[model samples]
Target: LTVTMRQRPSFVVVGEVRGAEAFTVFQAMSIGRYVFATFHADDIETFIHRMESKPINIPRNLMLTLDVVIILSNLSSDRGSLRRIKTVSEITGQDQLTSEIVVNNAFTWNSVTDTNPYSGFSYVLKRIAEKEGKFEADLEKEVDIRSKILDKMIEKQITNYKEFYNLVNLFYKDRVRLFETLDMTEEVLM
Candidate 1:
């Protein structure tokens, strides 16, 4: 399966990383391919440790290619059960002396503030900005705008997959049209 996947250029989605296939995922990521995958672990640190140990045994340096780690947790409240992204961390690099991977906290949800504040800086974003010849701050602002577009979609209950996909594409093609279609104001997003 890995051989077949490598033949073509595409995004790879591994349902779970439990065996030697984990090596393939890491290799794909290192080669500038996007991979979406899920693995069970208590937290980000545990996830990295698990991947570096036992059946997976992924090397530390190769792990640096993993740009983002999004942690989703279920929270029980008075209203009902809520599933939210607890944190978004970026793999900065590995410490040469300690041989430990460095993680940068890019975004975290604050219960007190009831908001997710982004640091506007991450290793991956810096690379992307450099490649695109734009400042990291510009890329960060684009991310903020896109996030607001998604929020508007969910708030409006536009749940269908096709509808959501089209909306996002529309946003890229014509930002003004997207705002008009969603009945959203740029001021609110700002």
Candidate 2:
């Protein structure tokens, strides 16, 4: 971890955060480096409890640096076993009185519909909007547009990572052209 930090990378990824490594991960996040790591926990509450106790013992104050937590779960169904994102939660802050981490679930999966619906307001999105000098509504529109593009990709069976990466880059380079090619329109924003 120290060697990687010396290289000054923009992002750091750990397969799984366990034991003392959690400290270093939080340290990297504290210094503004985006750290992505998978931790074993059934839910956000359990995750917090575990982190604040035992061998990990991550300080509750340090947990404030975490921006988001995406929980994935595997489920078995008539269609067989599949993995789905259970929740996408943003760590808003720590409660002043209780000192407990405040998390906002931006998206959550509905088992009945098998869809991950956006829960409306998102502190993470708001922060991003402020940083980019754009309205939160504009960012929401962008997310909707991108979601449509991804749906189109899935329909066309563009599952390969390289293909998805290249097409996403193209969208970034010329969004109008990409929309035209995908038979989509900016009308969704309206």
Candidate 3:
């Protein structure tokens, strides 16, 4: 396996391995390799089921190596709010009794408190900043920028999470256009 890595293939993407391959994949990841894969299940139990009864036969301990799991769900509602729900989860380790996952609270959602469109985003930014070792200013700046953006969003009467999310994505993706369209002052974005 080490010898294979010497070539550094165009890309080494593993396609949802469930058995012994899980051990190999975990070993590779632990050795500082990159993997971008999707799981059939959103939570830990589904993962366990696949491992315990799969052609690949994955070992329980091997699952601990996974660092991230992105959960994507569809609301399937006519009201059409938060249609593309993306929840990013990072695996810390296993629990003692249940022996399931222990998400490190890097960031999370509070259904009760996230009544506002701009909600829990600071926590997400904090986690990213923490990972990048740029926590000193990144988090604060993100919050300040987001707060300003939220003020403008509210002024524009944007309320739904979906619309707010799109606006945020668009603003970041095309900053010049958003600045021109929204007439965002230099003081707010900088």
Better of 1 and 3 by lDDT: 1
Q: lDDT of all predictions, in order shown?
A: 0.83, 0.89, 0.61
TM-score per candidate, chains pooled? 0.90, 0.94, 0.53
Tell me, by TM-score, which candidate is best: 2
**Candidate 2 segments exceeding 4 Å error:** 186-190
**lDDT tens per residue, model 3, 64-161:** 66666655555544556553424455666788998876764333444455432333334445656888888646676766666777777778888899
Error of 2 at 100 (Å): 1.1
Sorted by lDDT, highest first, which candidate order results? 2, 1, 3
Which stretches in model 3 have alpha-carbon errors above 4 Å? 1-6, 9-23, 79-83, 96-98, 104-133, 136-190
Model 1 poorest 10 in a row by lDDT: 1-10
Q: Residue pairs in steric clash, candidate 2?
A: none
Model 2: ten consecutive residues of lowest lDDT: 181-190
What global local distance difference test value does model 2 have?
Answer: 0.89
Better of 1 and 2 by TM-score: 2
Error of 1 at 98 (Å): 1.1
Q: Candidate 2, residues 1-190: lDDT per residue as tens digits?
A: 8789889999998998878888888889999999989999988888888888889999987888999999999999999999999999999998889877999999999999998999989999999999999999989988988889988887888989998888899898998777777776655435
| Winning candidate number (lDDT) | 2
Question: TM-score of predicted model 3?
Answer: 0.53
Ranking by TM-score: 2, 1, 3
